[model samples]
Target: MTTPDAPRHSRPISFAIFLAIAGAVGWWAAFNLTVSKIEVLENPSVDLACDFSVLVQCGTNLTAWQGAVFGFPNPLLGMGGFVAPIAVGVGLLAGARFARWFWIAFNVGIVGAFAFVIWLISQSLYSLGTLCPWCMVVWVATIPLFWVVTTRNLVEGVLGSSLVGFGAALRSWVVPITIVSYAVVVLLAQLQLNALARL
Candidate 1:
């Protein structure tokens, strides 16, 4: 996985740009959520801009126990966690080559983020019964980010040499795969929450 001999141009410029853009979007969503949380704290009954309706609002999710799974606002995690991808993307754009260990660790973080997003989706659709607008933006950013990074890592042999061929095969289908992933979420929301009518 170590690519000490790999040429500088081995880095994918498009992937770097995508990573930076996704990270920026996710960070923006997190920042908004953090501000909303602060406003709620300062005035418990304050209404947030993200609150659209009973079925489409951030108030419920923000106040729920799930929002603070780690005893703090969940958006705080995003505020800090998203910086990694931004830095990595900018580094790659600046001709910085990451070591194998770095890629492995970064991939692990992305996997964790994807998993957390899955959990939040479940909570939003089944338990919370509402769609947080800003949170959905975060989800949109994360879903594709996870897919692209994981696929790129596999294609680059960051995960393992044995999976390189499979990764290469999957790389070209990443966009479609991501679209299907989003479709599944939308379908679930429609089926369970009748989200389409509510919106």
Candidate 2:
């Protein structure tokens, strides 16, 4: 039931805060990765700060072909892409109301990022046989960012009205779902790379 007093897509302060925090964390990770990559380029002999060990380090992933999938360092993408969420969150907190089109575009971008993260996770665990700390930080932020934004859009009928109820149901389970998503990554890493023993 639509009412004048209550809009379908009301501002969510908590979601806004979440977005801000996640965006900041993601951006920080991307910045660190970019720095590491540049440092490697400047001096190949230098050991990176994030290189905790052979199995847990950023050097292997940074030098790999996967890190430059777009012919540029992947961290560049993160450095730029993460800014959008921060802006959107700050805008919402400032009482800005966005159009449905804006939300749709944002969601689409998030879906792309999510898909990319999944691919990176696969490449990291199965192919690279290593865990990059900065990359994992990006993953942690992206996972929940995707889930929360998508679910919020669904609840607000930005995706469609028909899915509102389903979105509402999912809203309460976002945290658990995020935890399970993280667990899946951990389990895969452990099974494939013996991440626990290596650490």
> Would you estimate the TM-scores of all the predictions?
0.95, 0.95
State, as a TM-score between 0 and 1, how close model 2 is to the true structure: 0.95
The alpha-carbon deviation from the true structure for residue 156 of candidate 1, after best TM-score superposition, in angstroms, is 1.1
Q: Mind giving the per-residue lDDT tens digits that candidate 2 earns over 1-199?
A: 7689875766789988999999999999999999999999999878999999989999999999999999999999999999999999999998899999999999999999999999999999999999999999999999999999999999999999999999999999999999999999999999999999989
Candidate 2 structure lDDT: 0.96
lDDT of each: 0.92, 0.96
- How much does candidate 1 score in TM-score? 0.95
Q: For model 1, give the 10-residue run with minimal summed lDDT.
A: 2-11
